[model samples]
Target: MAKKTKPIRPPADPLPPVIAPRVSAPPDPMSIDPEIQKMADDLSAKVHSPARDLELVDEFLDLYRRVFQQGNPIGLNEDITAVLTGRNARNGILFPPASPLIVKGQLVDRWGTPYWFHPNSSYQMEIRSAGPDKNLFTQDDVVKNPGPDNMGIGVGISQP
Candidate 1:
């Protein structure tokens, strides 16, 4: 008797490949054009200086205390001490020239970049960004367009 022949098996199908989600790169402050980067670096250097840092902290604290006493909206540059300590204090404070508070008001940065300010505590007093220009006109200068670069400060006083 003749031996029976065996049948050949079929090949299996290949599995589908997995795909990953695409992620966009974050904007780099250092890569914002050579000129802008240089300006930013300079401003950063100034801010990091030990003497400047101390002075800024002192000024911020003073502003905080002033706002706490006045119980009114204060601008970024207004002499907070005078407002809080003097009876001539206005009910509402104006934004100082190129003040961070101005950016907070306009909802944009020195380069027209937008940002948000969410104070973690009521006692918190100020918000600011020393952009490339290091000027306060962004908050106070009446110019419709205060160039593309300027520094700013924001002062706030919350209810007790």
Candidate 2:
């Protein structure tokens, strides 16, 4: 006896191609004043120097202390502030500016998970991550120290 074959089903109505949203590129970091750019370059170059690193870190900490003392307020974004202050420092020939400097920090909790923070805002202002080497919310992993053998902390300071 021959077996009957099942009839083929017709294709569903063709769906329109799904298009992804376009992402705008981030603003250029070089658009800042040439003087400020020079200062940033100078600082970046000295970030590895032993004495200079200590001085920069101390300057960063001092600025944060003052900002905290003034009470936490909104509109304290660091990127723009850094550029403004960096310009002043460059013109004044100051290694670091007198304004509050924002620097990135990373600490591993007891569970071995890293917690990111910006030292300029507030000590309690932590940038949380998902868990276990997973930087779910952050744009990238916490920057590691670039010193020889990673002896010092990998820190970045904002100009403001």
Candidate 3:
């Protein structure tokens, strides 16, 4: 009779790799201004709301007014975003780079379209959101045409 060889057994299961939890850094204390902090809090409240488009614009106007005293960000949406998050910003970073509201360096609306900004004067600007349709200059667009002093006058959903 031939001698049977002992079969070798497989090694025990190895421990799974350890994955560290992701942790975001806290906002810088020195960079936090009182007014800007208040605005940040206010914006955070309405960031995900559907019926607060006008309010959101008002907050943005305040931020622009505070940062660029000469005028609002005078360019396309992304350019404006640069000023908002740049060195001259009072709050350091009103819109954090990793924020969902910011996409590709531009502040995007709920429909994922960069907001259209029309400067009327040194202290007034018309902010427009593409609205649910995601098309500019449409009836469904939400617009905030601030008065000569950035006052809310003809602020509502656009008509045709």
Best-to-worst lDDT order: 3, 2, 1
**Backbone atom clashes (below 3 Å) for every candidate:** 13, 4, 0
TM match of model 1 to true structure: 0.24
lDDT of 3 by residue, 33-130 (tens): 66665654555465555446556655766776775566676788887777676545454565444456678988777778888787777676777787
Best by TM-score: 3
* lDDT comparing candidate 2 with the true structure: 0.37
Per-candidate TM-scores read: 0.24, 0.24, 0.60
- Give the lDDT of residue 5 in candidate 1: 94
In the predicted model 3, the residue pairs found to clash are none
RMSD of 3: 11.8
Candidate 3 C-alpha error for residue 154, in Å: 15
Model 2 lDDT tens row, 1-160: 8999999999999999999899898765334445444544544554444334333433433444453453222233343234334433233222233322223322222223433333333332323222334543333332222223222333332111
Steric clash count of candidate 3 = 0
* Local distance difference test scores for all models: 0.35, 0.37, 0.65
Better of 1 and 3 by lDDT: 3
